[model samples]
Target: MLPNNKIPEHLRSWSVPWPLYMPTFATPPELQPGPGLDASVAAGWAEPAFFPAVNDWPQRQAAALIPFQVVGGRPRNPSGRTGYTGRRLGRWGENQAADPIVTTGAGADRRVLLIRRDDCGQWAIPGGMVDPGETVPAALVRELREETGVDLAGYRAQILTTTYVDDPRNTDESWVVSTVAHYRLPETSPATAGSDALEARWWPFADLDTLLVAVADGGGRLYAAHRRLLGLCGGGR
Candidate 1:
């Protein structure tokens, strides 16, 4: 329910390392994404290599897209626990969605389209959820319109590689979830509509960081996704 960008200390791996955090939780059930999820609850996959322990990970159902990480716990500080209070299991809701990285040309006057997130004051590509039954492509286009107000039926576009975005969300010491990600693109002269965004317009590459960006996750994956988009746009220095 809280803004994901402001990841809580406990829910964050930054709290502690995996070696100390992995042993803090009770055993959990296996949960995988798709088909078995209720409309309100969606499951995601776990890469076995993510865990240092040899236990079987349960398929999980998270409310949204979030990354899960193994982190160590604190003792006698804020919560005033004695010692080793078991590991903290944490992750974000794994939201599966397509990011439509629409770009215009990069001539001296070129620019890329972006949407301002009123919630966090961050800039994010026009993207949203993958509605059930609708293919990714359609969902991408539809979400672009809903979020950034762009429709590309008659525009030139390309579907980039499929990617996964993991943003850590929960801190129950009993559950975790990892979200998946994808990308789509349509080239145009930076056009956008819809009141969902604080403002939508063409942004020069040089001023990208100045904008408050609110994409799903962080780390190299997030940076790399934008980098790949720049590569697709072909005007980065």
Candidate 2:
């Protein structure tokens, strides 16, 4: 557990973000310790067979190398202070996801596929969480098909990067990490929004920098972490 004096003053009094989906058993008062091991053990979400034990620092590091510390038997955020204690995310520790960067055309004509997220109503990469027991590649293909109705089976696919995502939904105990895969198609393919996407379409690669700048300036419609992910693809230069 982190020493009381070591916790930032502001965070020491921070309230947990109460999402409706969180179980009542897991809820706790502001600044109090998170759910206990008995609760997690009963919920079956913290089984060491599937997830790293709360105190298994070495195993957790080996899994994602995120450097999260154990605090009160829960994983503490390594990045810094957050507004919450217990997680709004479904699981404890690293919650893995996959981002599929589907693109068509070349040079100045390049275009990349994007989906309007239903939750935030912002344009983002067509991606979603990797289900338990699923491979990152499989999750990438599945998320692409589910969100944009695009099949990447025959496309030339390459893994671009795997890193921690600074998602807003992150809490002190849980955060997101993702694997980005780039898929290049021969030509523009038919796409329709499905699943959690409100709309899906291709956007000019040349406009990415502008859109990203708009986001930085607080006037853009792109998802924040996605902008960083897109920039890492080595496209739209």
Candidate 3:
């Protein structure tokens, strides 16, 4: 069972603005931190060492220094209030992720590879969390292979952008930041869905504007975060 972070009774009314409305929630059991807590710390909580304020971590590609203020021993989400405290995310601070944008053809004829995510059932670029000890470039390649069955390790990839994502899973204590890379292929490549992806397929680059408009209007099949990530890839204007 997961530990619950319950909101106070006084704060439970629907009249409360969403920013002020704290919801009772528990991090999913599967995403719970491992049993690595210090002897002095409580069980089911992340170790203090993982926190930026607790440790002097040198900035690296996999873990960039996205600033966050620590309050009551927890990192505060830099983007502002996210209702509840504690984290629905696995990490206590910045969760690093990598996105790979693979494309073929050029200009009007270009097509990009995308995957249908099992979690949200939205079509998104093939990507995943950057694992411990993995470089952002390596994570990009690995995630591409795992989600789309594309092997682009031999091809040159260009780093497009690295920025904090406005993911729904973000909380007051944890949030996601990602590095996006672009891989250009001379021709179409074979792609098969695997890992957390339900399906993988190619999409016309020109259609991204339409997709982005639909997503912005709140009725699209594209993942929310990917809308921003894809824009960094020169898509959707």
Candidate 4:
């Protein structure tokens, strides 16, 4: 992907294959991170309510690091544009999210953890943004706890995959990279709905495909990228 492609005017909003663009527009003032915009500040509009105070994160670990160019003092999506420019999203450049694929039960009774997101009301893997100065694994653990109240205290996580997510919420300036990790749960581990989740539960691995295909048909919407990640899990495909 070219670094400075201009974002097309019409090919935005969940384009099947996102359009290529060299960003030529200036970033709006509200999206720009200023002095007080650190880890706790909201950026631009309010739908995405939890933008970090600071967004000047240096290169760190992520599933994929998309090459970007500065367009009007902001990192522009290099692969292409998603049309909407930071409409409801928090960060301007890369928003790193980590998902923990926690599982329990054995064989036929096996199930994987899932959380219903408060924003989109879709069943999704418990995850959240990577805070600055935090390692990817630590961020994964913290986000998992904040969203689902599941603690993988002594569990060692194996990174399953790292890749750029085709998030529906992405815009020309905002994109996401997801790092998915596997964490097997002890038979006794407990999970409860917490933080930004509306509900938390384990789903039988056998039912994963049905759920993914039915996401838009009322079964439940799974976050775009998450659906793909779940396919990598055993039987979920």
Candidate 5:
């Protein structure tokens, strides 16, 4: 469901900034070799099966070889620390994306449901990229179902916010992902759906840290979630 050509402007900010698309010898933070580098980094688990693409590029652009990089057995930005150098084509390679932060939790007496990413096996809010053409909300719901098998029929999600997480592989490029978290009665959540999640389950609000996986900005999003929830509880009046 990828969009035809109109790149989503909202997603651009969610990726690595244009100026910081360089190696550590040049960029800041340089993606430290710590918890963020080890588990927080979103691994590209997209194989031909998950992400199907037409093979007409080679023939359509016959003699065109873009300057890019080939890292982690995948093509990347040539100037990227990953050393991906190939012909450049589109202004933004693959732009615009979305994610689903479907959570079920309450306050001191509440619990939050989470899953273990099969690829990384780390607990994370279920999410994925928003396809082209599909509306952000629709994509959010689709991804949520695909990953967890839970239904969001009654949850008309509003934008919680947008975030940009760092990508170590493409120090020259960025992975932009928009997240949509839908709240519901804990009983209706996938953790209770039985046949859904990989290992669908919930945790006490005080136990969120046990997972150790960071959200956008390395735990920044997690804090944001709590703060926003607090405002709602106070009636934000």
Candidate 6:
């Protein structure tokens, strides 16, 4: 579901300006298109996948609309091209991402693991795109390990929520949907920054408000979607 208030800064449209209105441009050479298996052959949990120009979004109560028409046979970003077009996110239209909130300790000592994204330099719960054939839970575990070196394979996670990601890269054609899950880390879990992260660290739940962020001219920080997700998980500043 869309946020009831203003879109969060990180997910707000950052597409470059176009005359009259912004339009999403093609993916740059450096960025590969979003990853996925062919829709024609998708099996099991991947059966319902939406492929570019291959499958139309199903008519159902659960499906969300993109609010724009297709361009070049691809979904068009309703808002326009984000500054980095396909640089970070590969696909347009319903990009699937997941976040795993790994917490450790308890009471006043409770802390959550966060990673500084290499591209944006902002602290956020570790997350990434879901490859075709992967379930949301599976993707969450894989992404958490890839970014923060935390193993959640044996941990029990609760599905906190699934909602549209207010990612700055969203366009009329491309937007993100994310599934957020939570896991209380074991006492022995050792987290190290890896993969797409610049650093990994644990922040006390009580001190979330004090952490400095790189977004909004440094006056505001924390990935916007994550801030909201954390709220739903009962973590508040």
Q: Which is superior by lDDT, 2 or 6?
A: 2
* Top candidate by TM-score: 3
Q: How much is the lDDT of residue 37 in candidate 2?
A: 44
**lDDT values for all models:** 0.43, 0.71, 0.71, 0.67, 0.40, 0.64
Winner of 2 and 6 under TM-score: 2
Model 5 spans > 4 angstroms off? 1-95, 167-170, 186-197, 213-237
Superposition error at 36 for model 4 (Å): 13
Q: Please write out the lDDT profile of model 3 over residues 159-190, one tens digit for every residue.
A: 88888887767766677888888889999888
Q: Give each model a TM-score.
A: 0.48, 0.71, 0.74, 0.71, 0.48, 0.68
How many clashes in each structure?
Answer: 28, 0, 0, 11, 21, 16
lDDT of 4 by residue, 103-219 (tens): 888888889888888877778889877766678899889988987787888999989887777766666767777788989886735678898888887888877777766765344
Clashing pairs in 2: none
Deviation in Å, model 1, residue 127 alpha carbon: 0.8
lDDT of 1 by residue, 1-237 (tens): 121233335544434543443323221333223333222133323322123432322332222233333234211122111122222222222335666766655555456666665544455566655654567677767877776666667654466555443212222332222111333343554455564566676666655544324343321112323444444445232
User: Candidate 1 local accuracy as lDDT?
Assistant: 0.43
**Model 4 misplaced regions, further than 4 Å:** 1-64, 213-219, 235-237
lDDT (10s digit) by residue, model 5, range 1-237:
111122235433324455543223221221333443233233322212111332333342342123333344334432223322221111122333445544444556565545555543345455555554567777767766666667777776756655442222222333333444445555634443222234555555555653334453222223222333322322111
RMSD of 5: 12.4
Candidate 4 deviation (Cα RMSD): 7.0
TM-score of 1: 0.48
lDDT of 6: 0.64
Q: Candidate 6: minimum summed lDDT over ten consecutive residues — where?
A: 40-49
- For candidate 1, what is the total of clashing residue pairs? 28
Candidate 3 minimal-lDDT segment of 10 residues: 53-62
